[model samples]
Target chain A: MVRLITHNLLACHAKGCTQNNFPLQFKDVSIELKEQEVNSEFVKNFLPRLEWKALVNTARQLGDTSLPEELPDMVDDDFLKALHHVLFEIHVEEGAMVCPNCGHSYPISNGIPNMLLSEHEIG
Target chain B: MFETPLTNIDYDKVYEPAEDSFLLLDCFEQEYQSIQQRFTGRVPVVTEIGTGSGIVTCFIKQNILPHSIFFATDINPTSCSTAAETIKLNDTHETHPFTFTAMQMNLTSAVRSNKIDLLVFNPPYVPAENVPEIPKDLDDSSWLDLALLGGQDGMMTTWEVLNNLENILTPEIGIAYILFCARNKPDQVAETMKARGWKVDVVIHRKAGWEVLSILLFQK
Candidate 1:
């Protein structure tokens, strides 16, 4: 499935398409939200390792403008809650993650993204 | 003992948890204290490659590491969907324990480098004449062959996962548990991993019918 948490870790691995392949752009996504208690400690620990710009842009693409373009000097509970929602709650039920460099489209059907490359695309 | 999560899994299409899978779970149980100690403070990114029934991933999440995010990948779309169901069934407690995501992809190819803290793989370790072709279509059931057949002493696919470990695992907190059978040569595999400068051990082993199954633990 396409969650920002998982999406953050995925890069285009099709053949030799290497440069600027990260943060696969979301296109035609069906978003689903589930309510869960925000764990501040987890969110805080994970925030430092996240790609801030990619996450913000992806959330915005999913019609969620809760995150800021830049992380604040001191992230408060509101920021942590927003990060938790963006990372854990929102799920892309149906869509395609297109590689920015390679132009390969990984289709998401039934909430699972098919990252299998074609025969010619396998390196 | 953690209950095996195999609810709603069509065993004919997806892999059914067997002795190899149980041996992996046993090792986790045996090393549960150490595992908990290793990841006590942080929210580790735990991933399982080739999640057949998603039983091992579900077990680790529900029982061993409740405070982690999990990513599971399977070449077989059926296994991916089946694993998602297994994860959902185990994560239904009101607390909403862990965030899990499944992808249909090759082993560890879709995951980012140095992001996974704990990795688990139960690769296809049965010696076979040929490594089966990976199914491409969404509804293709031929992937069940890829779930079990391992060419050249069942090491074809296993080697791919092992070689990619250095890139997939977080250097500080990475620990991988991989299953190997006697025919696949467990001792030699451990030696190879040790040669790669990893701290390796046969964490658990059991004689299951004709096959001798062992779970090889690796740390970077």
Candidate 2:
């Protein structure tokens, strides 16, 4: 389940590949919308931990450009719902996550991510 | 310090907080004081391999090291859902917001090597008499086979982690708690620890039914 929230924390870890690793790019991503029971408090609670720029950019990349160009000064129900939808509801079922710098790609299939590196790629 | 299953779906599929799970919980729950004292000058990068239900990771977050960034992996896709639910449910309480993520991955695969501060694995230690095929989640089945089956001698999954520990673990700061019972060869564990230049410290040893389980903590 490669949701925007999970994608927000991922960085490239290919052997000897360091710079420009954070927020690996999604390629040919297929999104699945799952409707979770909305818990507004949980969404509000998680607001601080979010990397707003990374998340908004990711949402745009997934063809969901609903989020505001700038984070709203105060969160409202509509905004929170959008955040919840982007962070939790969207799932990348099939795709590849490519590093911006190294161009190393990790594929996601059957909704399971293969984060394994080759023996030589192990640092 | 365990989050009971959030729902029936989780209870039926995910591995619950059993003795081995609680042992790791107790090891860190009771020992976090000492761990913190020793780590006064250091920070922790905690990860749990085969993080069935994500209770142990949540337990670590709420009870032990709340600030550490936790990563978890499980082969079963549903387990990831259950784990994310568990963290979201349990982490909603009074404690600080925890940073944790569950990925459907094989052991230590997606996680970057040499970055984990504490790698926890209370693996499927029981030896399965009739080894079951890995579940595809497309048919009528229970994937608990992967949860319980540890091959002939019960070292199948643990062996893989032990072999890859060198590449996955942080060089000097990494500490791992690998739990095993009477059947898993202790000698092989000693050899693995020796190869890593880490002395084995038994964090906990107790009888859970017929098996005497030991949660071995080591550093690399």
For A11-73, candidate 1 gives per-residue lDDT tens digits of: 999888878899999999888898788888888877778898988998898888999889888
Q: What is the lDDT for B190 in model 1?
A: 82
- Regions more than 4 Å wrong, model 2: A1-23, A28-96, A99-123, B1-9, B41-43, B94-97, B129-133, B138-142
Task: Put down candidate 2 lDDT per residue, B36-132, tens digits, no spaces.
Answer: 7654544465788888878888787777776555678887777776777777786555443234667766787655456676889988878876445
TM-score, candidate 1, first chain: 0.95
How many pairs of residues in model 2 come into backbone collision?
A: 1
Residue-wise C-alpha lDDT for candidate 2, range A1-123, written one tens digit per residue: 677776776677777887778678999888899776566666675576567898999899888988998888988999988888898788888999998889889888765566756567765
Task: Return the top candidate by DockQ.
Answer: 1
| Model 1 docking tier (incorrect/acceptable/medium/high) | medium
Candidate achieving the largest lDDT: 1
Query: How much is the lDDT of residue A67 in candidate 2?
Result: 98
